[model samples]
Target: MTDTIRQRAEAALAEVEQVSAVVLAEPTDANAIVPLKDADKPVGAEITKRMAEIDMSDTQSIVSFGSNAQAELQEISQSMLQGVRNKDVGPAGDSLRGIVSTIRGFSVSELDVRRKRSWWETLLGKAAPFAQFTARFETVQNQIDKITEDLLSHEHTLLKDIKSLDILYDKTLNFYDELALYIAAGEEKLSILDETDIPAAEAEVEKAPEGDQVMKAQELRDLRAARDDLERRVHDLKLTRQVTMQSLPSIRLVQENDKSLVTKINSTLVNTVPLWETQLAQAVTIQRSAEAASAVRDANDLTNELLTANAKNLRESNKVIREEMERGVFDIEAVKQANADLIGTIEESLAIADEGKARRAAAEEELKKMEAELRDTLAAAKSRRDGVGDNAGTAVPGA
Candidate 1:
C-alpha cells in the first residue's frame, strides 16, 4: 500500500513537472480584439451564448433605470413651482411697508407711494430695507429653480451612462468568453498528451540531443517564456472586467440622489406659494390706501412720486429674479457636461478590453496549429524509420 501510494505521488510529481503554466501577456498596443475564428469551439460557443443572454438583460436594466430617472425629474420640476407663489413674501412685503411708514414719521399723508426712484435713490432712501429683503427672496427662489434644472440635466446624463454601461457589459462578456476558451484549449491539449507519448514527442521537439544539449535547453526556455506571457494576459482581462463593474454603480448612486432632490424641491414649492400670495395682497392694499390718503391731502405730486418709486422697486425686483433663473440654466448645462464625460470614459474602456481579447484568441490559435504540425511531423518521422529498418533486414540476409 505504501509503495503504491509512493508510486502515485511520484507520478503526480512527474506530471506536474512536465506540464508548464503559461502566463499570457496582455497586448500593450490598443488594437487587440477577440477573433471569433481563433477560440476553442466549445469555449467559444458557450461564451457566445452567455454573452448574448447578458446583453439582453443589460439592455433591459439600462432602459428601466433611465426611464424612471426622467420621470422623477419631471415630477421634481412641478413640485418646485408648487408653493413658490406664497411662502413668506406677504409677511416680507408687510415688513417693508412698516419700514416705509416709519420713515415718513408715521404719517400716511406725507409719504408718497408712487415716486419714480432710481436704484441708487432707493438705496439712499428709507425703502432700502424693503428692497434688500425682496432682492434676497428673489435670489433664494432663483437658487432653488436653478438646482432643480441641474438635477434634471443630470438625469439625462445618467440615462446616457446607463446605455454606456450596457455596451461595456456586452464587450466585457465577449472578452471573458474568449479568454475562457483560450485557457480551456491550453489545458485540454495538455490533458490529451499521454505519458508514453512524451518520449516520442521530445524526440521531435525541434531540438538537438548530446552535442547540442544547449539548443534543447533553449527550446524549453522558450516554452516557459510563452507560458508566462499567457498568464499575464489572462490576469489583465479579469482586472478590466472588475473595474467596469465597479464604475457602473457610481452612476446609479448619482441618479438616486437626483430623484431625492427633485422630491424635496417639489414639496418646498407646494407649501411656500400661498404664503407669498397672501402677503402680496396685503402690500397692494396698503399701497392703495397710502396713495388715496396722500391725494386727499393735496399731495398729488408726492403721490405720483411715491407711485413712480414703487414702480422702480417692482422693476428692480423682477430683474434680480430673472438673473437668478438664468444662473440656474447654467448649472443645468454643467451637469449635462459631466455626465457626458463619464459615458465617454466607459466606452473607451470597453474598446480597450475588446482589443485585448482579439490578441489572446490569435495566440491561442497559433499554439493549436503548431501543436498539430508537430504531431504530424513526428508521425512521418516514425514511419520513415520503420521503412528503413524493414529494408535493412532484407539486405542483411546476404551477409
Candidate 2:
C-alpha cells in the first residue's frame, strides 16, 4: 500500500513538472498570428478612434524592454562635437565642416523625437502595476516564512517538555524502589527490638561483660538513621513524581498542539489549502485548497503570457509595416501620410484580433479546469485500484 502511494506521488510530481515545462516553453497557437478574435473587435475600434484623435506624429514609439538607445544617442552627440572640433583645427577641413554640420543636424532632429528614449523611461510609465506585483510576491513569501518559524518553535517546546517528563518518570521509579527497601529494613529492626530476651538465654553471652548489649543499642541507632534517610529520599521522590505526572496532561496537550501546527503549516504552504482549521483534521483540507489556488494561478499565468506575447507580435508587425513603407524608392510624403490610415487599419484589425483572443482564452481556461478535474479522477481511480489489489492479495488462498 505504501509503495502504491509512493508511485502515485511520483506520477503526480511528473505531471506537475510536465505542466511547468509546457509553461516555460511558451507554446502559442498559429491561430494567434491572425487575431480576429471576438475580444479584439471593440479594442480594435477603440484603437482606431484613438489613433484618429491623436496627431499621428505625436504618438509615442513602443520601445522594447532593456533597449540601448540612450547610449547610442550619447555616442552620436559626442561624434558630432568631435567633427566640429576637427573642422575648426584646419582650413583643409571644409569637408569636415560639412560633415560636422550634417552630423549635428541629424543628432538634433533625432533628439527632438522623444520616442527614441531609454527603455527604462517606458517601464517607468507602468510602475504602479509592477510595484503591486512585487508587494504581493513579498507578502506571500513572508507568510510562508512566518508559518515555518511557528512550526519549528512549537516542535522544539514539545520535545523539551517530553524529555523533562521522561527524566521525572525515571526518578519516580528509583524512589519507589528505595521506599520499599527502607520499609523492609525498618520492619526487621522493629522486630529485633520488640523480641524479649530470656534471662537464661542471655546468661551465657553475659559472660562477655555486657558488650553485646551496647553493640545492640548502637546497631538500633544506625538502622533508625539509615531508615530515616531512605524514607526522606522516598518522600522527595514521590513529590517530584507527582509534579511530573501533573505536567503530563499539559505536556501531552503541547505535543498535540505542535503536531497540529506542523500539519497546518505543511498544508497552508501549499496553494490549495484553507486558511482556517481547528488544529486537528484541518490540514488536509488546507492542503487541497492551496493546491487548487496554485492550479488557478498557473492557468492565469499561462494565459497572461500568451496574451502578452501576442501583443508583442502585433507591435512588431506594426513596425514592419512602417519600415516597408519607408523604402527610399517611394514618394516620402505619400508614404509618410499613409501612416495615419495604416494606424486606423491596424487598430481595427487589432480589435478583430482581440475578440478571437478572448474566445480562445475562454476555451483555454475551460480546458485547464477540465484538466484539474481529470487529475482528481485519475487519483481516485488509482486509489481504488490499489485498495482492490490489497484486498485480493490478503484473501486466504482456496479458502
Candidate 3:
C-alpha cells in the first residue's frame, strides 16, 4: 500500500483500539466487577481475528468482507467526473429546480377592471362596474386556487423524495463504515505481505536453478503480483469511501432545501394568501360603497343641469332661425369650388386604384417566379443528399 493509505489505515485502527470497555451500570455483586485488562481481552481477540482474516492472496472484491457483503462498493464512484451540477450552473440546478419552477410560475396579469368597465356604467348609474369587479375577482380567486394546487403537488413530490433520501442517507453511511473497515484490514494484510511473505518469496527465488526452480520463480512472481493488486484494491476502496463522504453532505443539503421549501409554501398558504383575500374583500366593499354614493350625486347633478339647459336651448334656437333666413341659398363661387374638389377627388381615387391593380399583377408574377426557384433549390438539395447517402453505403471490391 502507498504511504498515505497506510497512514490512514493505521490511524483508523489506532482509533478503534483506543475505545476501551465501558461499564453500563454500577454492579451490585462484588463478583460481577471485572478488572479493565480482563474486560478488554475479548475485544482485543476479536480485533486480532479480524486483522488475521484479511487474505491478501485471494483475489475477491474488497467490500466482500468474506461474503458478509452482497454488493461490492469499490465501483460506487462517478466522482472523478463531478457532482450532478458544476459551479457554472446558477443557484443549485436540479436540486431546487422543482421548487424554483413552482415559485417562478407566480407572475402578474393586466386585470384592468376599471378600463373594462364602460363609461355609461359609471355615469348612467348602473351596476356594471360591480358586475365587472365581481367577475374579475372570481378569475383572480381561481388563479390563486391554481397556485395552491400546483404548490401542493410539488410538496407531495418533495415529501416522497425526502423519504427516499432518508433511506439513502442511512445506506450510504453504512457503506462508508464498511469500506473503512475493509481498507484498514487490507492495509494491515499488505504490511504482512511486504515484511514476511515478499522477503521469503524473494529469498526462495535467489536459490540455484535446480529442483523446480521454474516453479519457485513463478510462485514468487504471483505473490508479488498479488500484493500489488491488493494495494490497488485498497486504493480504490479509499476513493469509494471519499465519494460516500461527499454523498452524506449532498444528501443533507437536499434535505435542508426541502425543509426551506416547506416553510415557504406554508407561509404562502397560511399568511400571504389569507392576507391578500382579506385586503381584496375590504377594497371591494369600499369600492361598492363609493360607486353607490357617486350614483346618488350624479342623479342630483343631472336634474339641476337639465333645468338650466332647457332655458339656454330656447335662446340659442331664436338666434339660429334669424341667421339662416339672412343667408343665400348658395354662393356661385362656393358651387364652382365644390364641383372642382369633387372632380379632383374622383380622378385621384381612380388613378390610385389603377396603379394598385398593376402593382398587384407584377407582385403575383414575381411570387410565382420565387416559388419555382425555391422548389428547384429544395429538389437539388435533396438530390445531393440522396447521392451522398448512396455513395456512403456503397462498398469497394476487395480480395
Candidate 4:
C-alpha cells in the first residue's frame, strides 16, 4: 500500500510539472494565443476539461471581468461616435451676428465711425451714412456671412471629432493596462503553483510512511491531504492560464482598434482640417473682392448720376445766364466752382475704382496660392496612404 501510494503521488507530481511546462511555454505571437503542438494538445485538452469540472471561480471571474470590460469598451466607442455627431462647438447664429457686425464696421476709414462724423454732426445727433452703405453692399455681405458661418460649422465639427478621438484613445489605453495586469497576475499564480506548491507537496509525500504501521498510516493520510491540496492548486493554475490565453484575442482586437482609430484621427487632422481651412480662407478672399467690386460699382453709379444731374442743372443755368446776358446779368464764379466740384468727384470715383481693382487682383493671387496648397496637401495625404499600404501593420489574428 505504501509503495502504491508513493507511485501515485510521484505520478501526480510529474503530471503537474508537465502541465506547468506547457502552460509556461513562450507564445509564438504577441497578438494571439500560441497554437498547441500535437504533443501538447492532449495535455492542454485534459487541463481544460479538468478546469471545467472544478468550476474554478477565479478563472470564471477573470473571464467575466474581461467580458464586461469589452462590452463597456464597445459602449464607449459608440458613445464617442455619437458624441462627435451630437457635440456643438457653438451656435453659428452668434458667429453669423459677429461676422455681420464685422462687415458693418469694415470701411476705408478703418471702421472709425467718429472720423466720418464732425462735432456739428454729433451735436445735431446725425447718424453716419452707414444705412446707404449697407443698403448698397447688403447682397455681397450676406454671401460672405453665409460662407463664414459654414466655415465656422466645419471647424466645430473637426474639434468635436478630435475630442472624441482623444476620449477613445484614453479608454483603449486603460483597457490595455487592465488586460496586461490581469495577464501578469495569472502568470504569477501559475508560477507559484509550479515552483512552490507542487514541490512542497512532493516533499511531504516523500517524507511520509517512514515509521511503524500506525504512524505511517497517519502520515499517509496527511500526505493524501497534501496531494489533494496540490491537485486543486494545479487545477486552478491551469484554469488561470487558459483564461489568460483566451483573453489574448480580445486584447489584440482592442489594440488593433486603437491603432486604426488613431490613424483615422491623424488623417483627419492632417488632411481634412487643413483643406477646409484653406478653402474657407479662399472663399473669404473671393467674397471680399466681390464686396470691394460691388462698392466700386455703386460708387461709380452714384458718381455718374450726380454728374448727369449737375451737368443738366449747369446747362439749364447757362441757358438762363445767356438769357440774362441778353438782359445784361450773369455769375461766372458759380459756374467755375461747379466745374471744380465735378472734377473732384470724378477723381475720387476713379481712385476707388483703382483700389477695388488692386484688391480683386490680390484676392485672385491669394486664391491661386490656396488652391496650390490644397493640391499639395491632398497629394501628400495620398502618398502617405499608399505608403502605409492596405494593412497598416501586421494583421493580428482574431482582431
**Off by more than 4 A, model 2:** 1-208, 270-399
Model 4 C-alpha lDDT per residue in residues 1-399, reported as the tens digit of each score? 123433433443443333224221223434232222321565445334323332222334433433333455678788866764775534433444554454455455522222457688679986554443444355544554354445434443444444444455555554544343333333444455467855665666666665555565555565445444545544554465466555545544544443444343333333444454455456456556666776788789999999999999999999998886775244678778999999999999999999999999999999989967665655555557675423532232221
| Candidate 2 per-residue C-alpha lDDT over 275-375 given as tens digits, one digit per residue, 9 for 90 to 100 | 22122134334444655676688799999999999999999999999998878776779887899889999999999999999999999999989967665
lDDT of 1 at 269: 31
lDDT of all predictions, in order shown?
0.45, 0.42, 0.58, 0.50
Clashes of 2: 24
- The numbered model that scores best in TM-score is 3
What are the per-residue Cα lDDT tens digits for candidate 3 across 42-161? 533433555565565565643344334314332233331243333232332232344335334422222222334467655876555456566667666666655655554454455555
TM-score of each: 0.32, 0.26, 0.54, 0.28
The residue ranges of model 3 lying beyond 4 angstroms of the native Cα positions read 1-130, 207-211, 326-399
RMSD of 4: 38.9
- Minimal lDDT window, size 10, model 4: 18-27
Number of backbone collisions per candidate, in order?
A: 47, 24, 0, 0
Q: Compared with the true structure, what per-residue lDDT tens digits does model 1 show for residues 1-399? A: 123433433343332232212122222323233344555575467435533332212334222321221244335334433533434323323433433343233233323444555787657774533344345444544443444344333333333333443344344444433444443433332233323333444665545656677666655554444444434433554454455345445534543443443333233233333344455456546766765776586676778889999999999999999988878545877899999999999999999999999999999999989967666655555567666444443433222
Worst 10 residues of 2 by lDDT: 61-70
Full ranking by lDDT: 3, 4, 1, 2
lDDT for 136 (candidate 3): 64
**How much does candidate 4 score in TM-score?**
0.28
